[model samples]
Target: MFTPPPSPFPSKSSELSELEMTHDTPTHANPSAFPTHSCQSKQKYTLALRWTIILVPITLIAIGVSTRLFIHPTSFDALSPNSIHEWKTWSKSLTDWSLHERHKPTENSPWLAIVPGTNASPVIKRSTLSATPAPTVPINPTLPTPFPQPYDTTLSPNFSTTSCYNFFLNMTQTDALRSCRPFSLLLTRSQAFIQNQDDINATNIDIWGTCNTDLSSSQCDLNMAWFTSSLRSSCATDLSNQNAMAVSALIGLQAFDLMRQAACSVDPVANAYCYVEAVASSDASSYYFYQLPLGQALPQITSGACNSCTKSLMSMYSAALSSANATSLTGLQATYGDAATKLNNVCGSPYAQTSTVASSSAPPSVDLTSVGGTWAVLLAVGVLSTSMSS
Candidate 1:
C-alpha cells in the first residue's frame, strides 16, 4: 500500500566507479561513442545531489507526522478544519473562565463573528451576546395567615408562633380561620380578649359622643351618655367575652356580603359562585363568615387605596367612606343596598312579594285550569280544520 518516491539523482560514488570501468573497457573507434570519465562522473554527482535535496524534504515531513501521532494519538482524527475550529473556541472559552470568574461564558451565549478559511477573507460577523445574568429568586418569609392549613391541630408550638400561623390563629379564634378547630385556638382567643379590653378602655371621647347621639339615653342605662360608656359600665365583660374570633367572623360576613353584591351586579346568578370564592378569598378576615372548599383558604388583602376591613360594619363602612372621599351615610347606604339585593335574590324568587297585594293574588289552581282549557280549545280547532281539508 505504501510507495516511496524515486530518488532524483544517482549515487556519485557508483557513478565514478562506473566511469572508471567504462574507460578501461575500451578505446572506442568512433569519437561520438567515446565517453569522458570526468564528464560522466560530474553529471552523475549532480543527479545524486538533486535526489538528496528532494528526499530530505520528504523524510522530514514523514518524521513530523509520526511525532505528532506519538504525542497525541487519540486526537489525530480531530485534526480536520471544522474540529480544529471548535477546539480553538473551546480552549479560548476555558482560558477565559480562569481569567474572568464573573464574566464566564455560558451555553446560552450567542454566536459572534465567524473566521473563514484562507480562500474566503472575511466571514459574517454575528451579533455578540453576553451570558445571561444569574437568576435572583425572591426569598419568601415563613409567616402564616388565614391561608388554609390542614385541619391538623397537632402541629408544634413553634409552627403556631410563626407570623403566618399567628395571624391565622388570631383569625381562627375569631372564627376567621375556618380551617382551624375552635378548641385549638383558646390561647389566641384569650389574648384577643385582652387586646379588645385595652382598645375598649382607650375609647376616644369623640367616638363615644357620636355613639350617644345615635343610641337612646334610656338605653344607656348607667347614665353614661354614650354606648361605649354603657359597655364600659355593664357590657364590658360581655364584649370582652366575644374575643377576637367573633369580631373577625363579623367582618368576614360583611366582606362576603359586599363581594356578593359586587359579583351579582357584574354577572348572572349562575356565575356568581366564581366571584363568591374570589371575593371571599380576597381577605383573611372575610374567611370567618364563609367556608372554603376542602383545599381552599382565604388570601390576604393587601393595604392600598382600599380601606382596611375588620369587624363592625359601621367602622368598616366608615373607613371605606373616608378612604374614597365619600360621605358616611352615602357609603353605608350604597353598601347596604347592594348586600340586601344579593341576599334577597339568593334567598327568594325573582318576583318581589309586596305585603299589600298578598290577599288579592289569584290561587295557582285557577291559573293552571285556565291555561289548560285554552290549550284544549286550540287543539280542537286544529283537528276540525284538518278534517275539513281531508
Candidate 2:
C-alpha cells in the first residue's frame, strides 16, 4: 500500500459513513447533486404515458369520423329488422307457390274437410256475390259499327277509340268511381289475365286485405261486378258479331270472374280447396276431374269420384253451364265449368302436372348456414334485393 500524508481528512470508517449518508439521502434544493440515470428513465416513461393519453382518444375519433363519411345508408340498412323480415316473407310465399303447396300444412279444421260427412257438394251455401245487370254495350259514333278485331291482347287504345270497351273501363277508372282505385286496374289486369290465365290458380281479390270481408265493400266492387256480369251475358259471348277486343275482353273477364268465385270462399285461404289432396296419387287424381278442361269438355258434366267438397264446388259452377245452355254460349260454359280444377294441378288432379316438378308438403322455414360467424345468407340476399327493389 502507498503511504499518504494525512492532515485534513478523518479516518477511513468515519469518511465512508458520511459519504454513504450523502448518497442515500437526497435533498430537494440539491436535487442535481448526484447525477442519476433512474430519474431520466422516469421522465421518459411519463412523457410516453402523456402522449398515449392524448393520442388514444384522437385515434378513436378519427376512425369514427372516417366510417361515417365513407359508409352508405343502404349498406348499413341491410342490418335493419324491417328489411330482414319483409325479405323472408316474400321469399317464403314464392317458395310455397312454386312447390304446389298452396296451403300451409296447418292441421286442417275438421269442419272444413269435404270428406265422407261433408262429401263437399251438398253442405255449401250459394254465393252471396251478384253482378249489377246492364244492357248491351253499343258502338259509338267515333268508329264504324263493326270494328276490325285486333289480335293483340295488350292494346289499351285511346278512350275515344275504344267505343265498345269504354263503358266498362269507365265503371272502374272514372274519377266519379275513385273507389274503384285509379289506373283502371281491371283494364290492366284483364290484359294480364289474357297473358297468364293458365298460370293463375286463385281468384283472390283480397290480396291487399282491403276486400276480405265482402266483395261489395271492396274499392273496386262496382267494376268487378260489372266486368263479371258483362262477360257472362249472352250478347258478349257471341263470336259472330263482336270485335277482337271483345274476344280479349271476354277471355280476361271470365278469368277474373272464375277466380273471384273461387276466392269468394266461405272460409279463409285457398287451402280449404287445397285440402282435397290425398296421401295416394291415384285416389287423389280420381277426386277432382270434374273441374279440369277434359271433364268440362264432356257433353254431360259428372263428378262422383272423391265426392269431396270440390264436388260441391263443381256443383256451384254447374249452375253456370245451365245458363250457358240457355244462352247457347259454349265458350263461356267451358270457362265456368272448370273452377274446381285448380291451377298447377294442386287440388286432386294430374291434368296440369308436369315431369319437371315434384310436389312438396309445405314450404321450408327461413334458414341459412352461418358463414364466417355472420347471420343467415338471407341478410346478404335482403341487402342485394334492397339495393335493387327499394
Candidate 3:
C-alpha cells in the first residue's frame, strides 16, 4: 500500500514548478498594500490643502483688523497738545512774513518820528484823508490815521477772495511793504501789542465789539463773551479808537495763530471750528488792512492758510472712520468722544452750541468709498479661497 502511494506522488521538480505557478498566477498573488496606504495619504493631503486655503486669508485679515484697531492713531492722539512744541516751531516758520525784513522799523529808522505834541513812535504816512473822520483821531501826526469816511463795519467788502501766495514768490521786502501798506495799522498794532500788553485789550476792539446787525442783543453779548475769552487780557472798558483798532488787529492775528495751530490738530470737530475761526480772522485782517491807503501793488489777502489743510484733515477723518472695521469702531468712537469732551472743556459754550447745531443739522459724514474698499478686499479674499478650494 505504501509503494502504491509513492508511485502516485509528484516528483520534487514538479512540486517546485507547481509552487512557482501559484506565485505567478493572479488569483493567488498578494494584493499591493502600498497602493491602499498611498490613496489614504493622498486623500488626507487634499483635505488639509483645502482647509489651509480657507483659513490663511481669514487669519491674515484678522491680524490686519487687529493692527488697525490697536495701532492706528486716534483723533485725540492726533490732536493732543503733547506735540505742541512741534506745532509751535512749524507755526513760527509758517507765519514768518518776509516783509518784516525790509519794512520793520529800527531805533535809527526814519519810520520812527515824533508828532508835534506826542511821543515818538513808528508811523506810515497816508496819502489821502477821508471825508468823515473816525470816532477817535490820532494825536501823533506820524502815525497812519484811520479813514475819515464811515466805512462799512462789516468785514464782507474788505475780505480778499484772491490768494496772496504769489506775492511772496520773488518779492522784495520793499515791494512787500508797499503792497502790504493797506495792513500797516494791523502790523503796527500787532508789534505794539507784542511789546506792551498794557496798550490794548483784544476783546474791546471795534472789529470784534461792533455787533452784527443780524444778531440779537443776547446773541451779540454771547459772541462778545466768547471773543473775550480768547483774548490775552480781560475785556477793557476804556479803549480809545486808536487803542481799539490796535486791539482788533492783535486779536485777529491771535485768532489766526490759534486756527493755524488747530489746523495741525487731529480732532475733526475742533478742526472744523478752527477752520471757521481762521477764515473769520482772515476776513477781519483783510477788512481792516484794506481800509488803509493803497500804498503799492501788494497781493490780495484771501482766507487763512489752513483752508487746504482743514479740507485734507476732514477728508482723512471721514475716510479713517469709514474704513474702520467693526473691531475698531469702539476705539474710534471713544477717541472722538474724548476729543469732543476736551473741545467742550477748552472752547466752552461756543463749541457746545456750534457742535450741537452741526450735529442736529447735517451730522458727521462717512466716506463710503473707504468702507467699500474694505469690503472689496474681504470679498476678493473670499472669492480667491473659493476658487482654490474648488
Candidate 4:
C-alpha cells in the first residue's frame, strides 16, 4: 500500500507503558523469572490434599485392624492365666472322678426282686447295693403277730420242710439288694421300643378285658375307646414322633420273624392287623431317618452336672449317623426340634439355652474334615491384595 512515510516508532515511554499493561493482564506474564505467591499457595494445597487422602485411609485401616485384634478370641487376654489355671484344676478333678467311677463295680445287676411290702424293686447283681436304704424298724418277738402264722411242719427231727417260695424268700437274707434303677444309656430308643410292647399289651387288656383275643370280639372294640382314652390321659407325652420312630425301627427289624405269627394269629384285630402289615412291608431303610440326635439333641445342657461320657458317646453316634446331604440334614434338624425341646425342658436354662456358636467353637479338626475353608479364604485375600497392588 502506498502510504505516507511510516509513522515514527512509538515513544519509549509508550512502549514501556504498553509492556507494563500487558504484563498486568493474566496470560501475558512470564512464569519463569518469578512465580506468583498464589501459584505457590495452590501447589501447597495440592500437596496437602494428596497427603490427606493417603493419611485418612491409613488411619481408618489402622483403626479397623486394631479393633479386630482387640475383640478376636485369638487375642492374648481372652483366656487369662487365672482362667486357664481354673480350667486345668476343674478338668483334673473331672478326670480323677471319672477314674474312680470306672474302678467301682455296678451294685445292682444279675437278679431283680419286686417286694410289695416296701414298694421297692431291687435289682441285685452279684450281691451289691447301689443306693442308700431307709431306716428299718427292729423286729420285736415280744409283740403279737398282726397276721396268722402257718403251722410249723417238721418232716424229721433233723430236717424241716420249706416251700420253694419260702426258700427263695430266705435267699434275700444273705443277698445285698441293688438300689439304682436300670436304664439304657445310649440304647434308650431300643429300650423304649420294648416298653412300647408292654404298653400295647396294657392297651389290649383295657379294651378287651384281656390281650388273649382279637378286638373283633363284641367287648374288644368297646374297650378300644377306653384304652385310647387311657393312653391319651397317661401317655400323651410319650406318643411323639421320636418314640414312634424308635418303635417303628424295632418293628421293622423284627418283621421277618413275626410276620407268620402275626398273620396266623387266631383272632387278629384291626390294629394288630395293621401293625403286622406295616412290619412285614417295612425295609431296613425304613429306620434310616435323615434327622439324627447329633449336636443339639444330646448336648450337655446342665451346668450343675459334670461332663457325661454317655452324652458325648450319643452325640458322636448321632453325628456319625447324620445324613451328608444338606436337604436331608435340614429335614432331620427340623424333626428333632420336638425332642430337642423336651431335652431343653429336662435340662432347664440357663444351661438349656445353649448357643450353636459354642458348638462351633471347637476346632475344625474336631469335625473330622480334612479340608477346611480357612486356607481358601487366606488364598483369596492374597490374590485380591496382589491385584490391588498391581
Candidate 5:
C-alpha cells in the first residue's frame, strides 16, 4: 500500500538522480546562490591582475624617482652664467671708479692719515672728561696685558672687559685668541674710520644727513671702548698679547674683503654712483682709521710678518670671490691680488694665489631629487587607488 502511494512520485533511481541534479544546479532563480569554485578563483585572480597592472608600474616609478633626488642638491655657487656676468660687470665698474678716486688724493691730504712706510696708528687724544684711570685689576699673567682701546662699537660698554672675560675664561687659549680676532678687527677698523673724519664724511654721503650721524659716531666710540677693554682683559691669552698687532692686521684684511662684497651688492645701475661711492667711502674709512692704527701699535703687524694670518685672510677672500658669478674675473682677481700684494709688502706671502673668477661655461647642476620624489608619490597614490577600487 505504501508503494502504491509512492506511485505518484518518481522511482527510487530517478528520485536520486533528480536530487543529484538539484544539488548540482543553481538553487535560486538568479543563479547567484550556487557559485562555482573555478569562477570565484577566476574573479579573485582578475581583481589581483587589475591591481597588479595598475600598481606595479607605479611602484617601479616611485622607486626610480626616490633614488634620483637623494643624489643631487643646489647651492649658491650654481647661478647662471648670465647672472654672474652682470654681477661682475657692475661690481668691476664700481670698484674701478672707487680705486681711481682713492688714488686722486695727494699724500699730504688730511684724509690720507696712514702713510705707507710710517707708523699706521692715528694720533688720538683721549678725552680727559671720559678717561678713567687705568685700574690696578688682577689679570691672568698668561694673557696679554695693557689692553688696547675699544675698536668695535657694536659691543656693550662692558662686553670686552666683563662679558668677554667671563666667556673666554672657560675656553682654551687658542680658541679664546681666535674668538678675539673678529672683535679686534672690528675695533681696529672702526677706530681707523673715526680717525679719518674726512673719509667718513665722504663715504657716508648717503647716510650722513638722514641716518642719525651724531648718534652713530657716539655709539661707534662707545663700542670701540668696549672691544678694546675686552681684548685687553678677557681675551688676553699669551699668544694674543705677543701677536696683538698681527691679529689686528689679519682682521683688518678680513674687513677689507667684507667691504668688497658690500660694494658689489650696491646696484650701480639703479642707484647710479651714490651707493657705490658711499660703499667706497665707508670702506676707506674703516681701513685707514681703525685697521691701520691697530696694526701700527705692534711690531708684528708690518709686512713680511704675520704669514699665517695672511694665509688665513687669503683663504677667506678666495672663498668669497669664488661665490660670485661674473663675466669678467679681472675685478675680483685684481681686488684680491692687490690685497695679497699689500699683505706681502706689509707682512710677507706664504699663501698660494687663488683663482678669483668662476667659469661661465661650467655646466649648471640640476637638482632632480625634488621633482623625482614628487612623481614617485603621485604614482604610489595611483597604485593605492587602483588597489582599493579593485
Candidate 6:
C-alpha cells in the first residue's frame, strides 16, 4: 500500500514544501499559486480605520488651534446661551478669567453668609414681594425719590423657552465675573461630560419666589440653604462625581447680599422680587453680554433708565465698595468703586452710597456645584445645590 503512493504523486512532506513555496512566492510572482493570505489585508484596514477615527479629528483640531491662543481673554462671538457652543465658549472664558489675579475669589472663602446653628425658613412667598424700603427715599436728591415710579408689578419679562440656565447671564460684570462667572464659564467645558445639552438659560433661574430673601437678615442665608439643600437629590446627585455644578450657578447667599446692598427694598418679600426683576430685565436684553469686559459690559446692562432695577444695579458696586471700606476686604474697593462710579454716571449717586448697604464684603464666589437635592455641599462653598455642574 505504501509503495503505491510513491508512484506519480509527491509524499506529504513534499506537498508541505510546495505549499510553503506557494506562500513564499505570492500569486503575482508564481503562475501556479494557491490562495495567499499575506495576513496583511485586515491590518491595513485596521490601521486606516484607526487613523480616520483618531488622526482626522486630531488633525482638524491641531489646524484649528494653529493661529489661535488657548488662555488669553480673547473676544469671541456671542452665542445663544442655551446652546452647547455657548456652554463651552463661556467655560473657556471662565478658565481664562480664573487665571487673572483681579478676577479670582478670596482663597477658600466661606461663600455662605448664614449664621451657624440656624435653620432655613421658606422665603418663596409668591403672593408678595418687598425689601422693607427706607422710610425716606434719598438715594438721589435730583430724582424725585427712590420709589419715584410705582413698582413695576408685572416685572421680569417672560420667555417661552425655560430652564435654570442663564441664571447669571444678566449678571453684571461686577456680579457675574466676580462671584458666578467662573462657574458659569464651567458650562462651556461641561459638554465633554454631557454629549447632549447641559445648558440652562439665565432667565430660567427666574423661578417664582426662589430668591425671596431679605439681605438685611439671616433670611437670605436660610433661604440659600434651603435652595442648596433641595438640590441634593436631583441635579447634585446626578453630577456629584464631577465636583462642579451647572453653568447658571448664581444660587448662593451672594445673591442675597446683592439684593440687600443694591436692591431697593419694599419688604422682605418685595426685596426678593426686586432682585429677580432686575436680573430678568438684564437677562432679557442680551445687549451687554457680547464678549465685552467690565468697561464695556457695565454700561451695557446699566444703560437702561433709572428704574428700581437700575437702582439696585448701581448699588451692587457702590454698596460693595462701602462694605469693603468697612471690612477692609482689600483689592475690592477699587474694582467695586470703578464699577460703581461708572454706574453712577449711568444711574446716579446715593444708590452706590453706603447709605444703602448691599453687603459688607465683596460678593463671594457662587459655587453652583449642584441643584435639586444635591445643592447643600456646593452652597456650602457658594454654588448650586447640585446645579450638578458641568
Number of backbone-clashing residue pairs for each candidate, in the order shown: 7, 4, 2, 4, 28, 55
Worst 10-residue lDDT window for candidate 1 reads 289-298
Best-performing candidate as measured by TM-score: 6
lDDT per residue (tens digit) for residues 1-390 in model 3: 445446578999999999998667476557773248877778877876777777666655543342232332122122223323476544554444222111223345332321111111222222111221212211222322321111113222221211221212212122222222222233233332222211222211222212122344344334433433433232232122234332443333323222222322322443322322332341222122221111111122333322333344333333434552322222222233333333344434223222311121112334332332234345656766775555
lDDT value, candidate 2, whole model = 0.34
C-alpha RMSD (angstroms) for model 4: 28.6
Instruction: Judge candidate 3 against the unseen true structure and give its global Cα lDDT, from 0 to 1.
Output: 0.31
- Model 5 C-alpha RMSD vs. true structure (Å) is 22.5
In candidate 6, stretches whose alpha carbon ends up further than 4 angstroms from where it belongs are 1-19, 22-49, 57-251, 260-274, 279-308, 324-390
Better of 4 and 5 by TM-score: 5
Against the true structure, whose lDDT is highest? 5
Provide TM-scores for the models. Answer: 0.15, 0.28, 0.16, 0.16, 0.20, 0.29
Error of 1 at 41 (Å): 99
Where is model 4 more than 4 Å wrong at Cα?
1-26, 36-41, 53-390
Q: Rate the local accuracy (lDDT) of all candidates.
A: 0.30, 0.34, 0.31, 0.28, 0.37, 0.31
* Local accuracy of candidate 5 as per-residue lDDT tens digits, 49-98: 77778777666554433432332112211122222357765454433311
lDDT sort, best first:
5, 2, 6, 3, 1, 4
lDDT of 1: 0.30
Assess the local accuracy of residue 202 in candidate 3 as a C-alpha lDDT between 0 and 100: 26
Give the higher-TM-score candidate: 4 or 6. 6
Candidate 1, residues 320-345, lDDT tens digits: the string is 33453232122133333233232234
